[model samples]
Target chain A: MTIEDLIEEFDDLGDWADQCEVLIDMGRDLSNMSDNLKTEDTKVHGCQSNVWMVAEVKSEPLRIELTADSDAMLVRGLLSVVLMVYSNRSPQEILETDVRDIFSRLGLDRHLSPARKNGLSGMVTRVRAIAAEAVGLQS
Target chain B: MTTDMSQRPPFDVEAVRGDFPILNRPLESGRHRKGKPPAFLDSGASAQKPQCVIDREREVEEQFFANAYRGVYYFGARVDEELEATRSGIAKFIGAESTDEIIFTSGTTMSLNLVARAWGGKFLEPGDEVLITEMEHHANIVPWQMACAERGATLRWLPLTEDRRLDMSRLDEFLTPKTKMLAVTSMSNVLGTINAISELARRAHDVGSLICVDAAQSVPHRMTDASGQHNEVEPVDFLAFSGHKLYGPTGVGVLYGRRDLLCEMNPFLGGGHMISQVYRDHSTWADPPAKFEAGTLPIVQAIALGAAVEYVSGLGLDRIHAHESQLLGYAHEQLATISGLTIYGPDLEHKGAICSFTIDGAAAEDLANLLDIRGVFVRHGHHCAMPLHEVLGVQASVRASFGVYNSCSDIDRLVDGLQFALERLIVAEK
Candidate 1:
């Protein structure tokens, strides 16, 4: 499903319990991650939960494909949302997108804690950094 | 293992709960229950301020707020007297020899750092060692590491046993002649393991090493006799505790030092009030406390801390300890019934009010968030003790620490929240 569809799904959820249930379900559907990808380089710092992310630069469309995982179910769900927004996007597109507003619109900002919000932002920054690097390499 | 509440003097937890305004309010999240009172179980992090403490703070701000020791005006004199009153109260509370022993700092972290820099900086020599423990919070561990590095001394650790208790058997091996200091926590913030401070203090003294205590966790939960007055515990050279953890205000903590040691140690921070005479090139320092307290103190917060001490003292520490002990036992009894739950630390006998645990599949963060949804507040993650978490064989764990305001009902809500989290998260895994 598209990121907008996921946002709509979150909006339709009743309370925190419903939101949490749907989020954990999204986490369950996360792409299978290898132990090798879960390295120190991919690890997100200043997070209460362990989160690892990787970005692969695709030459065909010049898009960045993001894959990530977290030991925390909520963080995994957050990763899913993050990947859905930034993955398969051009470096310029990735840089220009307003994902923080998108997260706030989805009510994830209100639902997730300040600490978790920091982790989410950290993921976004990592993806942007990779895309920026790709732009550098292309230049 | 829980005591019969009927046999003991009735601890009116409901009345106590009324004193903490936060306990009466609904959760700000407004998630599941609309009007459920927040079950605050993270007092180990920082206790909720009592109404008296809050009032005391407001009184200072509204009535007679002034920079402490700055002026001879009525407000300034009143502020100084208030601060000195707190110093005397705290000195008495911890069974210290004199109010001169009490040196106020920003918090426990600063108190510890002062001891490390002022004491260790002057005293530590090459080949000397500072022995700490694996279960110490980062606040207790990092300062010593910095001190040892700067002073050319070695930092050693007293390891925890398989059950997370300190390895008392290895005491001789760790505490050597070279051990200039034995910095230990009175109680583990994560494991809730109450160490035998008296024994450790005695042994450290036997080896001619000064014993410093991180009493942040213990001072609130149990009676602390820092000077060994009316207690079997040996007099510790240095002791540190935060006011916030004792149901006071933030931005204030106490560092108790032996009179002789405080006199001998160099000033930690060189600034306005800490010195007696200033010269163009060099300056003479003030006595013990003023020497350590270099800057303008947390005047309002420190005054309110005096109220916090009075509040707790009026209630009696023994009663609070007994009440929390019952709650801890009840929590253990209930949590054990959960299929995959594993509580860390020693048995009920050796623990304080903290209960840190992890489920087989549930992440600590996820569980804590779920608990929050149910209006149950708990602390998660390594609890600022990464080495202890490493020793406990987990990256993170959920901690439910009790205070005087907590009751058995809070534990019930915690269990219910945990079960709900388990059903939602663990079931989704399959």
Candidate 2:
């Protein structure tokens, strides 16, 4: 399903337990980021959990390839949402996309704990920064 | 092989619970039909403040907050006068020789840093070894590493054994004549293994080296007076604990040092209050405790800490220790029933009421989140003891450390929550 569609599914889930289960489910299905890419530069700080995100430059169509991983299940689920939205998008498109607005629309910013919120924002910010850098390097 | 060794606690835990208003706070799941209180199992990080401590802090802030030691005014002078009394109480609490030995710092971290910088910086010569254990929290480890770097001293560590206690077989090897100091935790925050502090302290002294006990965990859970009174051990040269962990407010920590050593040490931070007399070119330092306590003190928190210590004393440390031991024993029995659950630390007998565990397929962070939703608070991650976790060969673990207010039912809730997390998150997927 698309990212927006999954968020709607999250909104439909009435109980906290159900939402948590869905998030954990998302985590279980997440494609593991290769260990080689999980290096110091790719590591996201300010997370209570360790999270690493890396973006590979795609040629021709100029789509940005993003991969992320977290030691925490909830953080991994959040990373999945970022992967659904930002991955395989053109560098310009990824930069233009308001990820924070998307997160607000999904009510993720309010739902997650302060620590998790910080982690989510850190992941999103790092991805956006990489996208911006990737676009800059091409020019 | 297990025996029913549990005895009834002397004091009323329910009455103790009433003193902590935070325990009565309505959890997200609300209170139980059986009247179970909120399971606060993370006292190793910080404890819930009692009403007395809260009131004392408010009283200090609302009525008697003025810059201490500088004012001749009624409020400021009164605060200073009261603080001196509090200093004596703190000294007696840890069984220090005098109030001259007790130095207040920001917290355990700041206190350890003070010792490492002031004492280690001044005394540590080239090729001198500063020894610490594998189980020490980063607060106790990192500062010494920095000190060793500054002073050209080598850092050595006594390895934590597979059995979760320190390997003392090479005690002589680790504590050589070159060893200038030994920094050890009174209890491991993760493993909960109580170290043989007095023996180690005596050993260190015999070798002509000093020892510093990181009493941050032990001070809250049990009696810390180094005198041979209730489950007491001989006091070491330096001891440190945070006020917040002892049911007081944050921003206050006590560091107890030997009077002679403190007098001889150079002042860590060069500031106004730490100086006795200031000259344009140089300044002579103040007396030991004041020499260390530079700048405006955390007056409110310090007063709250005094109240906290009094509250604990009122409860009686021996009684508290016994009660927690009973709960911890019961918790061990309950946890043993769970499959694929591995707990860190020595078997129940030698440890505090801390249970650091990881389930077979469940991640520590995931289990903690699930437990949080169920109103069972626990600490997850390295718990500032990453080196210890590395030694255990695990990335992280969930720690449920009990305080005086914790009950047997709290452990039940934790175990039940772990089961729910396992069934729903880990097993359901399969």
Candidate 3:
């Protein structure tokens, strides 16, 4: 689903509890990332949780597909939300996306802010780097 | 949540709780949870300030504000007198011989850094070793590591046993002739393992090694005798603890050193107040504390900390310990009932009032966040002790630590929060 759809779903939720429930459900719904893919190269540093993320560049469309996992259920749920915004999009598109605004609207800012230096922000940093690298290679 | 309070003296917890205004005020998250009072179990991180301490700080700042020891003005004299009185009170609190041994620093981290840099730099030689524990807070470990590396000294570890207590059996092997210093925590910030400081001090003295204690966790909870007058232990050469952890303001801590040791050591930070005679060629240093306290100290905070010492002294650490020990037993019993929860330290007998644990599928941060929703504050992650976390065989764990103000109701809320978190996150794991 698109980031807009996710935002709408979150907005429809009544309170923090509903939003948390939906987030956890989304985390549960995330496709299982292979254990083998969770290597040192895929690890995201500066996170309190153990998070792993890998980005693949689609040659035809120059789009980045992101896959990630976390030992934390909430982080996995956050990964779902982050992935929804960044994955399956062109490198340029991902670069232009305002992920912070989206997170603020969802009221997940307090739960996962950049100040935390946690999984969500670390994933975003990794994603942006991969996208920028892809752009650098293309040029 | 009914604790065994039969053996202890009458502890008026409600009266104690009334002194801390923050405890009565509902947390910001309480809006969602029907204005629930905060079950602040993160005192192991930093205790909440009492109104008296807060008032003391305001009284200092508003009434007689001046740089300590700088002027002969009335305000300056009042400030210096107050600072000296605070220092004397602290020395008395820890049973230090003289007020000069107590050097005020920013916090426990600063206190540890000061001792490691100043004392270790002056004494440690090549081929010497500094023995520390694997379960120490990073504040205790990293400073020593840096000091050792800089001074060409070897750093060694005293590993923890399976139950998370220090393996004292290996003490002889670790404490050799070359062991110049034995730096250890009085209590583990994460595991709550209360190390035998007196025993360790005796053993270190036997090997002719000076012992420095990171008492950030211990000093607030129990009695500490640096001079070892009443306590069975030998005099601790160096001891450090933070004021904030003792329910005072932040940015103020005490570093108690042996008089001779403080006099012999060079200053960690060289600046204005530390110098006695200043020439362009070279400068001589001041007496013990002034030699160490090189800048404008956290004047108001230190005075407030004096008030904190007074408050804790009035309540008596004995009663606090009794109340907390019983509460800790209750917490252990309650937390154990939850399926898949594994507490990481020894039984109540071997530890303090802190509880660190992990559930089967719920991650530490997730559990902590969920607890916050219920107005229960806890600490998550490695708690600045990564090596201990590695030893515990987990990436991270949730910690619910208690203070004098905490009650059985806090534990109930913590249990309630954990159950809710388990129901929500564990199911999500599937």
Q: Note the DockQ of each predicted structure.
A: 0.79, 0.42, 0.58
Better of 2 and 3 by lDDT: 3
In terms of TM-score, the best-performing candidate is 1
- Write down the worst ten-residue block by lDDT for model 3 chain B: B1-10
Can you list the residue pairs that collide in candidate 3?
Answer: none
Arrange candidates, best DockQ first. Answer: 1, 3, 2
DockQ of 3: 0.58
Q: Point to the candidate with the largest DockQ.
A: 1
* Per-residue lDDT over B1-430 for candidate 2, one digit per residue giving the tens place of the 0 to 100 score: 1123345346788899899998997754422223345789999899999999999988888887898889999999989987888898888787877788888898999999999999998999999999999999999999999999999999999987778898888798899989999999999999899998888988898888989889999998766765434345555888999999999899999999888889998898888699999999999999989999889989888877899989988777778888999999998899989999999999877899799998887788889888876778899999999999889999899999999899988899999988888887678777
Error of 2 at B348 (Å): 1.5
Worst 10 residues of 2 chain B by lDDT: B1-10
Candidate order (TM-score) = 1, 3, 2
Tens-digit lDDT track of model 1 for B1-430: 1245456668899999999999998666547557788999999999999999999999999999889889999999999999999999999999899999999999999999999999999999999999999999999999999999998999999998988899999999999998999999999999999999999999999999999999999999888898998675689999999999999999999999999999999899999899999999999999988888888999999989999999988778888998999999999999999999999999999999999999998999999988888888999999999988887789999999999999999999999999889988887567
* Per-residue lDDT of model 3, residues A64-116, tens digit only: 99898888777788888878888889999888986767888777785654635
Summarize candidate 3's per-residue lDDT along B42-100 as a digit string, tens digits. 99999999999999999998999999999999999999999999999999989898899
Sort by lDDT, best first. 1, 3, 2
- The clash numbers for all candidates, in the given order, read 0, 0, 0
Candidates 1 and 3, the one with greater TM-score: 1
